[model samples]
Target: MSDWLDEIHWNSDGLVPAIAQDPTSGRILMMAWMNRESLALTAAEGRAVYWSRSRNRLWRKGEESGHVQRVIELRLDCDADVVVLQVEQLGGIACHTGRESCFYRVLRDGQWATVDPVIKDPQAIYAGGHGHD
Candidate 1:
């Protein structure tokens, strides 16, 4: 039998874009990259796991912040290149900036506008100091 991972059309870097969505609010929380191991771990663990390109390692969501995403469902786009995860975002935070989502900025009058307010102080969220995505 073919492996389920084989069905995904990974990019040249062997990574696929994964989007995390709030299952209840239907709001997009954040997006991350996933490699085969990270994707498999997410399914097996029933939580969100992603490949940290900057850290060059498997990043278990909320490992540092205690804001884990409990994945309820996983879907693949028609082209089988993108993945979406319906998740219950713990602690009501998803962005490293302590915002509800990474998409807090909107294009307004050709300028980026910050709409969503930071739910928590990033300094309180990250003990080692913020700036992680």
Candidate 2:
């Protein structure tokens, strides 16, 4: 059967690295994994859906934290081994840590430093006991 998913060069575990980017700022928000089903669902649903390796299931962005990513565009890398989603991050938060992005650390003097401040308290964001990470 002909399928668009076949074009992607998924890894042995049937997963591809997906990057989420803020279309407005062009800043990378997060990176996650996506399976065939999740990618297809993301396209159909017009949202960012990822494969949660830890949970062993599909994860719809903002499902628990109300930080949904509305996908603006989806792209495959030149190698066809990576997926990138240009998205409008809902609530302006993309990290479970309540920061704007997951890559919030800066490497300085051979050490990692957290430079981004949490816009909203994680305690307040995940008040209902939903796991963020």
Candidate 3:
């Protein structure tokens, strides 16, 4: 297992893409970047942790929204370039836009379309809160 960890092909940015999926439903929830620390934290804590490139810090998924993802399984591709996390999502909506998944937009014939409606209001979920901000 340690050898597998060492074999992960992190790029020059020292980051790799991690895909989060719903374990029960087999639905892909979201995709985020993970550095080595984030990967270690996620594996140790059994929760999804990601490296926030914009903020230049580690972020726990759903920390602000109360939509934490509990990881059930972590998988690496044959090439060890990408990781897939099977998780049990705590919140119904995994997306900041109030959708179940971040992939709310679908590309159709050279256009992007919003296929899924917002499941819940983000403001309502994080009312008077400071997590996302």
Candidate 4:
């Protein structure tokens, strides 16, 4: 297992991009970064863990909003530089902006368009505060 872990191609920043998708629905939830430690934790715990570049720390999905992702499988790309996490999403919405996915907006005809409606209100979900105590 260690040898396989070592084979992952982490970037210079010691991070890899991880894309999360719904296992049952086949919907892409979001994309995040992961370090070696985060990847290990996710594998061991059956949960999705990510390294937040903005916060400069490890973050467990749904830590705040109870929107946690339960990992079903982890896939490494051919280059081993990218990871795809098949997960069972607890919450319906995945985007911080209350959309089902982060890719709610799309650029069409050289203009940005709202491709989908907001599934939930982020403010309302986080209003009671995150799950972390």
What's the lDDT for all of these models?
A: 0.95, 0.94, 0.88, 0.86
Per-residue lDDT for 62-122 in model 4, tens only?
Answer: 8887788899999999999999999988877778777778878789999999998977766
- For candidate 3, write residues 1-133 as lDDT tens digits: 4655688999899999999998888888889999999999999999999999989999999878888989899999988999999998886778877789988889999999999999888788778754342
**Which regions in candidate 4 have their CA more than 4 angstroms from the true location?**
128-133
Q: In model 1, state the lDDT of residue 37.
A: 99
TM-score of each: 0.97, 0.96, 0.90, 0.91
The total of clashing pairs for model 2 equals: 0
Please estimate how well model 4 matches the true structure, expressed as its whole-model Cα lDDT: 0.86
List of clashing residue pairs for candidate 1: none
Model 2 Cα shift for residue 104 (angstroms): 0.6
Model 1, backbone clash pairs (residues 3+ apart or across chains), number: 0
lDDT of 2 by residue, 1-133 (tens): 7798999999999999999998788999999999999999999999999999999999999988888999999999999999999999999989988999999999999999999999998888899866674
TM-score of 4: 0.91
Write candidate 1's Cα lDDT for 1-133 as tens digits.
9999999999999999999999888999999999999999999999999999999999989999999999999999999999999999999999999999999999999999999999999998998885763
Question: In model 2, which residue pairs have backbone atoms overlapping below 3 Å?
Answer: none
